[model samples]
Target: MSKIIFVNLPVSDLNASMAFYEALGFENNPQFTDDTAACMVWSEAIFVMLLTHDKWKTFTNRPISPITTSEVMLCLSCESREIVDELNDTAEENGGTADINPKQDHGFMYNRNLADLDGHVWEMMWMDPAAMTN
Candidate 1:
């Protein structure tokens, strides 16, 4: 069986986080969702579990990071530069903070960063397939 990835993030507001992710095109899996947690499906192999702070502590004793701090940066690839920009815009429109870092365009690749309402950094990028061969 292929290995699947499930990234669990602690959210202050489960309903808001679920709405934010939905704006970015992720589908919610109701089968795995409830009041304290929401299962957002990025793909068949990738899922993000957004858990309320109370439920999150059940799995770990570590304190949740502050809103201004970042524990990790999650990056997702887009099919084109336009798509990257579109996602960034959607994120911003839906309460995510966009342009946290300077935009990058290296001829072969383009990327931008945004922070979710809970301050999780997410990088959106696009790369030219042709560049991989060279």
Candidate 2:
């Protein structure tokens, strides 16, 4: 059984995609590095498998979702409000856009949205562990 969770995304450019994710503090798994796909490690067990459009097509015959028309949004949790801002800023510096309104800071949790160069939406957020129960 596979122990790691892989979230695959279709990308237009491998280098740009890698750089974008790296700016968000992800490390590339060299073992899986290749011309068509890259394994990005977010945590020990969490990863994002980014594939070029051509490579992604090999896995499914179904139509790929256009970022604007797609129904999927990738959500990632951070350690704190500052982390949320840090990730978003990195994305922006790497050619992504802050496609949504700013965070709704509720003291215990903070959240915001960012759209990558491919227009894929990612939720950048932080939730206080201490406040989760109260």
CA lDDT of each prediction against the hidden true structure: 0.93, 0.85
Please provide, for model 1 over 1-134, each residue's C-alpha lDDT reduced to its tens digit, 9 standing for 90 to 100: 89999999999999999999999999999999999999999888889999999999999999998999987988888889998999889989999999888999988999999988899999999998787745
lDDT of 1: 0.93
For model 2, the superposed segments whose C-alpha errors exceed 4 Å read 99-102, 132-134
TM-score for every candidate vs. truth?
Answer: 0.95, 0.89
TM-score of 1: 0.95
Per-candidate alpha-carbon RMSD to the true structure: 1.2, 1.9
True-structure Cα RMSD, model 1? 1.2
> Considering summed lDDT, which 10 consecutive residues are worst modelled in model 1?
125-134
Candidate 2 yields a Cα-based lDDT of 0.85
**How far off is residue 19 in model 2, in Å?**
0.6
